[model samples]
Target: MSLASTSLEYIAYFSEIVLAIIIGLAVGAVVMWIGGYDPWQAYYQLFVPSLTTPYGIYMTLSFATPIILTGLTFAIGVRAGLFNIGAEGQMYMGALGAVLYGAVSLPFFAYLPMEFLTGILLAVLWGFIAGWLKAYKGVNEVVSTIMLNWIAYWIVETMRVYVIPNPIDASKTVSVPPSGRLPLLIPNTELSVGYIIAVLAAVLMYFILWKTVIGYEIRVVGYNPTAARYAGINVRKVALYSFILGGVTSGLAGVCEVAGRPPSYAITTGLSNLVNLGFDGLTVSLVGANHPLGIILSSILIGAMKAGSRNMQIFAHVPLEMVQTVQGIIIIALSVPGVVRLIIRRIRR
Candidate 1:
């Protein structure tokens, strides 16, 4: 393509992204107003708290850990036109993998490799099953992945309650050994080495998806499987690869949680909180146009909203559900461009 064409394409892409962000904010504002609150105050509640104290910053980073990883997982699947909805299950498997490694005999240094590898492997295994089903059994990936998630939940519940029984005292939650914990790099902060790892993962994924032939093949397959086959690419293989890759990323998110945040195994009340991570990652990827860097920025924005929502509620007397409403509005407005266009037209009229 000519340089002018390339420049125009980049401009168009960036413009769409800006529009998406604006739409998300506008919809969120509207929702907040409908709730009988000032939208600006609602926005302040969502963003201001994390900026006020060190503890708040720490909390924000802690929340961001899994989100960054899950975003990547979601990005891979969506890029390939496959809905790998079993991220919740894959995350559980990854957590199990980390826990199992922590439960065994190992040195501190060994903990890092052992935990990460175990989580990655388990998640990949889970992802592979869905991929296999789709490839050979002609099963829909959506259905297969959803089923796998249920199976994963049972698997983890079994291990948590009976098999091995990793309970922290009689609390029924197992605390990881000192060695299994991530090394904190900052004083008085929850920030850990995992943040560095998360940053690296983002960079690596960018290269994998943009600079490699495999990425090209995956994109081609995703855009048109039949055409990919005609172009001599193995669509099945690429699809399977995308699913597995997505699983690995989700597994890594589990690792971040186990290593960086909780550093212990609980019954996963955070499951509801974390499961949507994969979904959030899906949104980030979509809003970002599946660009790796874009996904990271989007993840950070979401992390900020999550971190700030509590403060917003506490300080502004805004209901916490407003945050959820805002997120929903953003999803709807961005995902349905036609609606936005209509709204814009009406406003113009």
Candidate 2:
């Protein structure tokens, strides 16, 4: 494509996302008006406090950390022609691996690396199961991953309750040891080095996908597996690589959540702290056009909304469900273009 054409395409793509945001906000405003709330005031409270304050920015980045990694997982799968929803399960395995930190004693440097390695390996194993089933056994990845997710959930739950329960508080798993905990990036805030690491991971993914031979093969396979094979690219290997890379990133997400998040550095028996993050990442990935760089921006936006929801409730008296409805509307609107493209491709095939 010519430079002018490429520029035009970029403009159009961004314009679509902007339009979707407008539509979502307009619809949300109408909903708020009907609910007897001042729409303008509600929106102001929802955005300003979260975007304009230092503490809010810190919280937003902190919340953005894990979702960024999870979103990368989904984005990688999409780039490799897979609708991999296995990040949830892989993340569970990763969290379990990180939880081992509380079970063993080690030097600070060794402990941290061990936690990350263990988590990534376990997550890769979990992802490999689905990848193997799809690549070799011809099983549908969607079905396999869905089943795996529930299995992972139960396994983690069992471990939390029976094996790693905190002696001081049985409702949660044992806390990460001080030596294993990530240092706070900002004083008196949940923000930690995890956000920085997440951003670096995004940058690394960008390099891998846009500037590497393996990435070229993966993209080719995604574009057309038959064509990729005809071009001498091993389609099955690309599929496996995609899943394993996704596993690495999602595993990091789980490890970060357990080791970086404050006041709890531990998994609750209910898994409340880690629930739905992987699913949320799917939304983030779609909104970001399944690009690593875009995902970083999208994650921050979603994180801001999450951080600001409390302010909306406290200041505007908007109900939590109402705020959630607004967020859902926004995400669905943002996702429409991606969904339509997928449908078009499937129909053509």
Candidate 3:
């Protein structure tokens, strides 16, 4: 394609994404009206808190950090033309691994690297297995990853409730040792150093996707495995590499939640908390056109909606279900091919 055509294509893709979000919001407003809720109240809750309160901003940042990582996970997989449905599982395993690290106390310098590395390694191993099953055994990653997520949930719960340092009253795991925790920068706030790490990850993702030879090969393979193979790219290796990258990104999300947000570990916490984020990552990936920087912004937008919803419920008397409906509308608009194509056509004209 000519440079001008390529540029036009990029514009069309981005326009589609923007249109999806707008359509999503419009659908959400309709859902609210049909549900007998005030659409103005719903919109206020969706947008107000992040603007009004410091705590809301802090929570928004906290929410943004992990979703950004998870979004990156899905984005990487999609870019490589692989459907990795196992990010939730990988995230759970990573959280479980981080909890294990939390069981022991180590000085700050030694603790940070060891704990982070452990989480990443565990997630990588899980991802590797999925990739191997897909590449060698011809199993579909979507199936394997979905099953893996269930296994992860059970394994983490079993370990937390029965295995390590479990006390009779231990519904929650013990607080992570102070040394194992992520350092806090914002005083008296939920915000932590994870935001910095998340930002770095986005920048790193951009560089890898646009600047690296390996990334180019991965994209080529995704575009067409036959063409990539003819060009001497190892399609299997690239797929496996994409799987590993996805796992690692999700792992980072797990570690950040355990180390920074909660300041400790809980049994099945990752699995439970990731209910929205796991799926939302797919939304973010779609909304952002699978671009790293775009994912970050999209994540922030969603995070703000989530964090602000509480205030809307408490102060504005809006139902929490309405918030969820809004999110669903957004996701559906992005996912449906016909809606997106129509939007793109309109924008192009």
Candidate 4:
């Protein structure tokens, strides 16, 4: 019975995903038509080669790495009964932590662990401030997190201008040291050990959230705070723990963006550098049904969009907003399970 129920759940999950994608595509097609673009050609150009070619695959994975970590951040927060909009701030702080530690000299092994931990710790503290405020002072997590994003953004931008501008390019920070960078998995590709790191983090989250006592407490608290309190679970502590854990993963995203991409070493150099990853994570988490494994697959799809959207205009003159429109429709379609269920019911009937 349990196995049958599980299989049924999996089927439903896959069904929602497929339906959401189709709806998203349908909406995207209408938008393309209105915008005077060929939807078929646009989508074909946008998706066909993303994973079919070597460079495309590498770029797709590279795009997936950070968002996967951020998706985990958001998904875990959902499980903990909190809406953590502060992953953006936590991500920035994490990158700052990497930069701060990279400035120092240490052994190869020591530098790697130390710098990565620094990112996690910094993000934890950033999250701790908001979590404590929410748990104790009655502050709203959404407002606090949004404010924190701007605060961290300007803080980093200010520091960029006055504190750590690169000697060669005053626009960006100094390069990360060789000891701190993640080695490439494939030669001459952007793919790095960050992919491995992200997968490991996902597995660990699944175990911690599903297979452990603490995870049980967190989920219980998320499901019903009042009940969990009556049951003697420390709701406040669990809230703090959830925020910190979310921050840790988001921070790791920032770290990977910094340390995983060598030679560049500077987050500022890239356009939209270290930005929107947290927002993208929210989309990814929702698309993945807030499951760790789901986030991995969702991130890949979104990543493919990211890598392939670049050529949309070149091949079909489809504006980049076309992709955003599809993603937004997908998120909206999935956000309300009622709609998905209704569609599924009609199909089954």
Name the best candidate (by lDDT). 2
Q: What does candidate 1's lDDT look like per residue over 1-349, in tens digits? A: 5999967966776687678779788877777787888888777767766656676666677666676777787677766767677777888888878777645787667886888898899999999999989988889988998789889888877776665464545433365567777878666576777777777788888899879998888777666677788999987888889888888888988877766665343335434434566666666565555667776766666777778888778777787677677767766655554234334533543
Better of 2 and 3 by TM-score: 2
Candidate 3 residue-wise lDDT at 200: 92
lDDT of each: 0.73, 0.89, 0.76, 0.81
Tens digit per residue, CA lDDT, model 4, 125-150: 99999999989998999899999989
* Model 3: per-residue Cα lDDT over 1-349, one tens digit each: 6999978977887777677777887888888788887878767766777757787788888888888888888888777877777878888777777778656767767766876898899888889999999888889888998898888778877777766543534556655567777877687776889888988998898899879998898778767777888899988898899889888888888788878876334444334655556667777776777779988887777778778778768876767776667766776876664336434543543
Model 1 RMSD in angstroms:
4.9
Error of 4 at 69 (Å): 0.8
How would you order the candidates by TM-score, starting with the best? 2, 4, 3, 1
Show where candidate 1 strays beyond 4 Å.
1-7, 51-58, 164-172, 263-273, 334-349
Q: What does the lDDT come to for candidate 4?
A: 0.81
Error of 4 at 72 (Å): 0.9
lDDT accuracy of residue 208 in candidate 4: 94
> Candidate 3: minimum summed lDDT over ten consecutive residues — where?
337-346
TM-score of 2: 0.96
The superposed Cα distance between candidate 3 and the true structure at residue 115, in angstroms, equals: 1.3
Model 4: residues with Cα > 4 Å off, grouped in runs:
1-7, 269-271, 321-349
Ranking by lDDT: 2, 4, 3, 1
Best by TM-score: 2
